[model samples]
Target: MQTSEYLTNFSAGIAPIPQDQWQALAQHCGPFLQYSFLNGLETCGCVGGTTGWQPHFITVHRHGTLVGAMPGYLKSDSYGEYVFDHSWANAYHHHGLNYYPKWISAVPFTPVTGPRMLIHPNADKQIIVEKLLEQAGRLEQFGASSCHLLFAQDFERHNACHAGYRARWSVQFQWHNYDYTDFDGFLSALTSRKRKDIRKSRQFLQASGICIERRGDGQIRPQDMAFFLSCYQQTYLKRSGHTGYLNQEFFEHLLKTLKNRLMLVIARQGDVPVASALFLYDDKGLYGRYWGSLRDVNGLHFECCYFQGIEFAIENRIPLFNPGTQGEHKILRGFEPIYCCSLHRLFASEFDAAVGEFLDREAPVITNYYHQAHNVLPFNATFRAQLISSPENKKGHF
Candidate 1:
């Protein structure tokens, strides 16, 4: 079974790697990158078959001992990844090239950023990165036109850039806890107008006879999950004319395997659930993943998704809240703009150069948008003064 002293192997699925061993190497990574989460996607049929995501997990071993791994998929279409490449695909089509089958290293349907290259703490990072890039380059043999590492960590993105991948930039809104005491304390830092607007939203929900309940771990029952899934599918159907990317089995598996890390916020009117927001968290932060409503009440979406997540983070002492992607609306609700990057390597040289030129032209615009968005943050003068006075502010950490 042993091939070489140092071997890099790509599995058709993650089933080959032992869960405990793989998890040990992935220490400190987020729940999305965990063994259970990725495996659930495969086992529940959310990823395989006609879903267009085929697991192609990469693993590195030395003397038959696992040292490095990455969650990878052979994607037939650019559907779930938040890093949009449909334009690139169109460009390929205009050039009379194929771009359908591509390789991506990311958590399917999850846009939150973390480590794409999962390396053991004691492993040589540079060597692992080299082996990974080598394997990515070999995707051409499998009829893949490109390899994308989406929503990668800063270090991994930099490494990929050094290894000659084109860097793509995007922005997401996230709320940070600056030692706030509670939800009211969080609002105190916001501008007067924003504070009033938020208060009005909450008042609308309150006056509608809607009661918000936060359920986590042991409190989240099977009925709650079923209700959440119904709402999730209904929302997706209304928006996309189809059900969601995830199925009930996928969510049920997540609930069973990642119970403690999962949190659900249910909005009820006189003992009947009307809406729900699902979140995943660790000690570091909370991530708002999915939300849907059986009934529409004014300002209900904002209260269920953003405000509830903020309250939960504050009460639990979690530092940050990433309320999913792409909304200028979140900025006014106290979520600040955060920069995220992805890396890509196209197999065709001519297409690669063209895409590189496009990215070069696009980078400055994205940077400018981020800066503009930062100026519009709703923080009051006192909070702005506090941020300016902090040492981390000097380094532009946020």
Candidate 2:
């Protein structure tokens, strides 16, 4: 597709684009959208191979100068994407249509919302968005059933919707920093019962002789990663019948390449690590990406995953914390409900119409669920009033 002086091109992999050029368009986005992170997934065998994700990154150039790009992948299954599309696949199956291969613009195994369409500050955003939609539509030529962009930012979702994509909504629990001075300051804003429960959970950890340590960037050692991987594998093996989706190599690559953006919170008993939580962040927000523990302690999970994250965010002045996808348990710990969006375009008109109808009916339910979750937030009446008075609440963005 052409946009004035620009032309769109699709690469078999992210490797074709120079790292500097790709990252230039990703300025101020997020770590997940960076060239090193997405390319690391491919180089480390996380996305390519049998992992069902095959890179097909899209880029736009003006007179051979890169201007915009999107992280695109050809999928063989709906396994890693948090956006569930199995029902749609089954519908396609019943109709004797193939849905194995579909196009998606998302970071592998990441649910945090950020910019999916990366355009240079100087580029024409409207033209870039039009080229993006045109490229997605061209997926039909490859026999793909649909193209999807998951966990897209608000503006990206709006542009995609205007481009004739159907919007699907989901809810994720996230913590917002409101200039709290410390962890106690945060808890004081919560209801008495919630404040007590959180205090008790942390006290329980302390009484159990568990101490938490935060390791950022170069502070994380190789041995620490080994221990964390053991916990990660054991947790997955116990929960599911197999190991987790990521491998030690993938994490090692992450540590080596994106170490500066990494945060590792370790729960230890007198220098012996028992649990670990790995987080990633940029200037905008912190993402609680993964966590695991060797032994089950009464309150260790909440301490390592939720409380420590809150404390870190408070101390660091990070405004947002996404502690992963689902957990009603987060509501009690001060995570508020926020709407996450994904856009879809099915190649088949019949399936497209059907899925659009399904989304049209489902969107209201998701919105209602988001509202219902607010009722269960642990914020006290006074704090809730302040929150409701904020501009974000008025806009319904949170």
Q: State each model's CA lDDT, in order.
A: 0.89, 0.87
- Write model 2 residue lDDT over 88-147, tens digit each, in one string: 999999989899799999999999888899898988888888887788888888888899
Backbone clashes in model 1, listed as residue pairs: none
Clashing pairs in 2: none
Which digits, one per residue and each the tens of the lDDT, describe model 1 over residues 198-247?
A: 99889888888999999985589999999999999999999999889889
Residue 248 displacement (Å), model 2: 1.4
TM-score of each: 0.97, 0.96
lDDT of 1 at 75: 91
Identify the leading candidate in terms of TM-score.
1
